[model samples]
Target: MAFVGVERAVRQILQDDADVFALVGARVNPAKAEQGPATPYVVYQMIANEHHEMFGGSAGLANALIQISGFSTSKSEVLDLREKVRLALQGQTSVVTVGADTFDVRSIHLEGDRDIDDDPRDGSDAAIYGWAMDFRVGYPEPVP
Candidate 1:
């Protein structure tokens, strides 16, 4: 792709959102995000936020995507990659470059009782419930 072409393609791609997949299509669960987890090639463990009795919300779903970028075709490579991820996740990794993307949303929500950050002295204007909308984009990996 040429630079000019890439610019146009990205502009179009940015205009749309990725399609979300069913969590239990072939697995066993609901779904979250516009799409599912990244990949399931080399899962060291399950990423979930399961409660003692039941699984939590998207927290459980988000945890399902494991990071295997450091995986190596050889055992030595795997060991090295594990160490790299360990250090990287621990803020030991130095980024060579960085990039980001954003989205424009309309309506949004603020749940939980704590969202009420109002002045107690002026309780007359206190809010019982509120609602709004806003665009949201996903940045699956940022700490790296």
Candidate 2:
């Protein structure tokens, strides 16, 4: 079975970082709602995954595509948050312990980033600036 420890690890790393935490507190969410929380927040989702196959159809490694999006009232704030996320995650290869199972993260690479247009769901005066970042994370799969 494929373990979702990578997601947990990413969230943990972001939450642990002082710069990211100071901006959003603990507002990191997976597939966040269209309208929720105040500005200056983060939302992430697992976009895709590719498994590496060895001989006899055995898989030992997998690449997970993750999308992390930052939102705020100002463009600068969202861009800053996106940079903080990149600093905390890019090129990180370490053992992330989630529960009893520990998964080794091989690496994290920033695929790309884009700016989201101002579209406020709450109909407030503030213009919501968003930054979407895509990353490819490689990790070891659990062996039976």
Name the regions of candidate 2 deviating beyond 4 angstroms: 1-4, 99-101
TM-scores for all predictions: 0.22, 0.88
Residue-level lDDT of model 2, residues 19-40, one tens digit each, is: 9999998899888844657779
Top candidate on lDDT is: 2
Q: What does candidate 2 score on TM?
A: 0.88
| Runs of candidate 1 exceeding 4 Å displacement | 1-46, 50-70, 91-144
Give lDDT: candidate 1, residue 74: 40
Q: Report lDDT (CA) for all predictions.
A: 0.22, 0.84
The 10-residue segment of model 2 with minimum total lDDT is 1-10
- lDDT for model 1: 0.22
